[model samples]
Target chain A: MSVINDLLGGFATALSLANLMYALIGCVLGTAIGVLPGIGPVAGVALLIPVTLNLEPTSAIIMLAAIFYGTQYGGTITSVLLNTPGESASAITTIDGYAMTKKGRAGAALTIAAYGSFVGGTAATVGLVVAAKPLGSLGLAVGPPEFFSMMVLGLALLVCLAGDSMTKALISGVIGLMIAMVGIDPVEGAPRFTFGNEFLLDGVSFVAVIVGLFGLSEILNTGTERPGKVETPGFRALLPNRTEFRRSNPAVARGTVVGFLLGLIPGMTGSVSALLSYGAEKRFSKYRDELGSGAIEGVAGPESANNAHANGALVPLFTLGIPASPTIAVLMGAFLQQGLTPGPSLFVDHSELAWGIIASLFIGNVILVILNVPLVRVWTSILSIPPAVLTALILVFMVVGSYTINFAAFDVFVMTLFGLVGLGLRKLDIPLAPLVLTLVLGPLMESKLRESLEISQGDFSIFASRPICVVLLLIALVIAATPLLRPRRRKTRSKENQHEAA
Target chain B: MHEQNQAAPPDRPSPPAGPGPTGPPGPAASSALAPLIGQAVLALVAAYVVFTSFGLGLWSHIGPGPGFFPLVLGVAMLLLALSWFVQERRRTATPAAAPAQGAATATEVPEVPVIPGIPSTPAAGTGDGSGGRGHVLAVVGSLIVLGLLIDLLGFQLTMFAFLLFHLKRQNAVRWITAVIISAVGSVGTFVLFGAGLGVQLPAAGIPFLANLGL
Candidate 1:
């Protein structure tokens, strides 16, 4: 009941004309970006961040929140139609999504994804609304050690989530952490790797890094490959049949729960939850043969999980000041831009603003579905466009987007430089996520570490002495150890076997 | 079981085969240099990070100074680079055996091994491989040219020229489509940064537009 009231309070603020309009624009633009291959929600959000600087803080936040959820909805269409996933979250969709497309059921797969995302996103937003207050309290208690441990765990998960070789993933993650070290040191106020360039003082902006890595590299790579040609499915074939719906219903439900839980944890990326949900669905599937054969459940499970996680991620960010993902770090930047501290006081001092953002999530999810469904064919048409042209547009957007950041050509130059480096990393098969997440968290981690030291009078044992920090550290150790020690492929195989048995 | 799986008749034809010189048909073969480039870039970036961290005087930070973690990160990065470099070297030196067996059965055997800098024609029919390495190099080269051209020609003219040229070169799309996409893309760029979002874009060549309150 209290959760419902709080959500209503949120709705009252979010529904205000200015905030609502921002949310609507965010949803519309975010979806367009999400439909394009090589353009993920993170880049879409980052690129748009500078533009939002002029808006009222709450409206900006609301718009950002809308973009985040909107991208989650938009990304699935391409994965289904073109086999070119718009975001990492949609990669799993490509398995069965492309299969369904091949079987002439692409429309159904897309529809399920759109609808499932709505349910999951809305459910997770409700969770966010309910837990906002307590979550903020929890955030206040997190010091440096806890933050550090959480990031370490996140890095471990990055390695685990990165495909194929664990060693490669670890190396990639370490490289990311290294990149995070480039700018001015958070605690010491000393420049690290600027090479005497003024831009290095602020470090490589996360927006520039993400755009270069995911957007530019994707363009460079996709240009090298033959882009898929997709034929749009008819409207009659868009909705799933009864049997298809029945199969996907349970998977979507499971995905929503899993994504919600994973999303609430600080530092866990949204893609992780979506991928994990997909993995779980495959492991528990009754129609095992349908696993990658255009299974409606495949599209439903991952899409729902991705959107759910996107919503769930806000719980930690809104309630706890700790950002759950890099995009959230950008959101935190927006809050800071407004002179708003995003800790416990955010909920207490700015209840309407906080709740409004939460409430808007529900409204956004509904709007995303409403906007995306009839536009399914439109999105598919957008996806079917040549990759070369699509990538060219991305290049233009990235250039303009970066330039908009500081209204300086310098930012664009930095974007291109990072983009070249990102292109090189893509060439070498290094994962870009760790580097990004680390960069986003670095300043905060440094600040918290310094605060902890000051409070504990420079005692290193303060990390272990704090119960929450100790537990978080242990969890990090476990997460790290599991990937290293566990026979990952064998575990997947055995899980497959169990599914076959069931 | 193999017979059961081979439900289709011989010469009933496979999906019009993918064109890449490396690997089997489809997307995996398409991603020939993706893994290679991704790894190398990561290594280079890591090296740069290490160099920067060293400049910060990694270990000599006074009580929780920014350089402290960076020092640890630098050492970690060096180790990571070394490991990555070794792995890439090993993979290149020893080509996997399975691909060799698969290659034996493929049609249109090349007279020479596919090497860097060699320009192979796009395989007939498939259109999947534009000898990707060449295209990758071409794009990079064009960008370099664009960079040089920017200060000389100014940002807008350079961007407009680059956009027009790259769009035309990359694919054989309709000239009208290309022109429209370029115009819309360029104009959208102007509107988004200049008018809509109210952020300034590079206005080197067109001083008039800059003065027009755009």
Candidate 2:
């Protein structure tokens, strides 16, 4: 009842014309970029960072949060309408989504996606309200050692669950940490690896690196493909039949739970959660044969999971001062830039603002369903543009966007360099998400560790002394051990063999 | 070593696939030899990391230094790399190999004949796969040359030349159009960053381009 009343109060603030307009702008811009193939929410949010720099912190955060979910919702249109996937999270959606289009049930797939996103997003937001207070309470007792151990445990989670090659994943993670080390040492204020270059002084601009890696790499990949232009049909009647709805309901429920849980875990964000849910659904679904053949469950599961993951990732950010996803990392950055510390204290200090953002999520999810479902046809038409021309335009936009960050040409060069590096990593089949996540988390982890060490007089035993730290370490050890012992791995191999035999 | 194998395509017939060169160049390398190459690359990277961290003073610090974390990372990498190398060698020593898939497209060479008449794409898409490596090299080479030329000719000229090359190559635009577009792009960038945003553009050796009329 308190949740509802507090939410109603939040709604009054978020419902104001100015705040609502920011949310709308964020939603529309997020949808536009999200519908475009290659660029993900990471790039979309990063590109918007400079623009939001001047806005009030609450409005900026609301807008940024809206964009994050907006991309998750909008990305499904391309996956369904065209064979191309706008985000890696949507790749599973394409398997069934494209199949649906081939079967002339594109309208149904699009409708399910929009509604699934809304349901998952709204559910996760409700979960946030329920979970955050208690989690924040638990976090209040945490100190630097607990925080450091948790981060290490989080990084370990990525090592275990991130796509193949634990060694490569670790290597990439270390590289990210090294990149984070380039700036001044927080403890001593001594320069570490800048090598006297003024550009190195700031230790690689986050905006420059992200824009270059995601935005630029996308352009390069776009340049590689043979563009297939298609025209989109507009304004379809958006309703799922009883049969379609019935089939998807269970998957939607399962995906929401799966995505929410995954989001709660640091390091594995929306993309991983969505993919894992898709895999789980395939393994357990009674309509397994219908999967990858336009099964509504296919669309429902991943779309729901991705949005749920996006909303639920906020739980850790607001409660623990740990960003569970890259999008949240930027939002955390925004919070820090505003001189606000994000932890248990934030809830007590800024209840209205926090609750208002929470309240606005419900409004945002409802708006996304209303706008995205009827407009998916229009969104799908965007893919019809030639990849070459489209990528060129994106490259131009990336340059303009990066330069606009600090209005520096050097930043443009940095974007290009990172783009090439991103392309190189792609060619090697190395997943970039862990690298980005590590880079985002590295400095905070280091600072917390240093703080803990200083507080403990260099006694490392403090890490194990705390109950929370001990539990997280044990969980990490168990996660690290399970893969080596799991019998299901062989079964997976057998399935792969069968797939190859087919 | 086993960890490196995780990056390779599965079903290489070895219990713990050695980190060797990634999958077969074609299909047959899956038996034993391919993983050796992958292991070698991983090993090399591991070695480089160790050397770099050590050279930057990892172990010699009186207390905790900047190199401390990297040293731990390097040792971890080394252990993994060595494990992979040993696994690959052990696999290679075994003799019986699985039947390998022959290059199915050997007789049917996938070729894209360059049309003598058609203008080449300014962009590299739809080109022969050969151009992929070439495109990467070209971009790298372009950057190097721009770095060198910027001091002599200035950013505006270098960027203009670079854009002109792209406009002509990919878009196959008319000379006038290329010139106009390049000029507009360069000047637009200058004004937007320099005047509007208060960014300081690099001054050109050429007098006219240096003066923003500020």
**Candidate with maximal lDDT:** 2
The DockQ figures for the candidates are 0.17, 0.12
TM-score of each: 0.80, 0.79
> By DockQ thresholds, what CAPRI class is model 1?
incorrect
- Candidate 1's error at A279, in angstroms? 4.6
Q: Over the stretch A1-502, how does candidate 2's per-residue lDDT look in tens digits?
A: 8767777888997898978988887888778777876667888787777666666777878888888888888778777777666666676688888888787788888888888898899999999999878889889988878888888887777776554446555656765676677767655566666768777766677777777777766555444354355545444535678899899988899899899988898877676677778877888888988887789899999889988988988999888888776667766766765667787888889888888889889989988887787777666666665444454445445655665555456676777788777665544434556566667787788778767766776667878788888898888888777756643675588689999999
Query: Total backbone clashes of model 2?
Result: 16
- Candidate 2 chain A minimal-lDDT segment of 10 residues: A387-396
True contacts kept of 2: 0.03
Cα lDDT tens digits for candidate 1, A162-281: 534456566655555566666676765777767798877877665666666656655555463444676778878887898988888888998999999988776566666776787888
Model 2 residue A380 lDDT score: 64
CA lDDT, every model vs. true structure: 0.67, 0.69
Off by over 4 Å in 1: A1-5, A98-105, A224-226, A266-272, A275-291, A325-345, A486-502, B1-62, B85-156, B174-177, B205-214
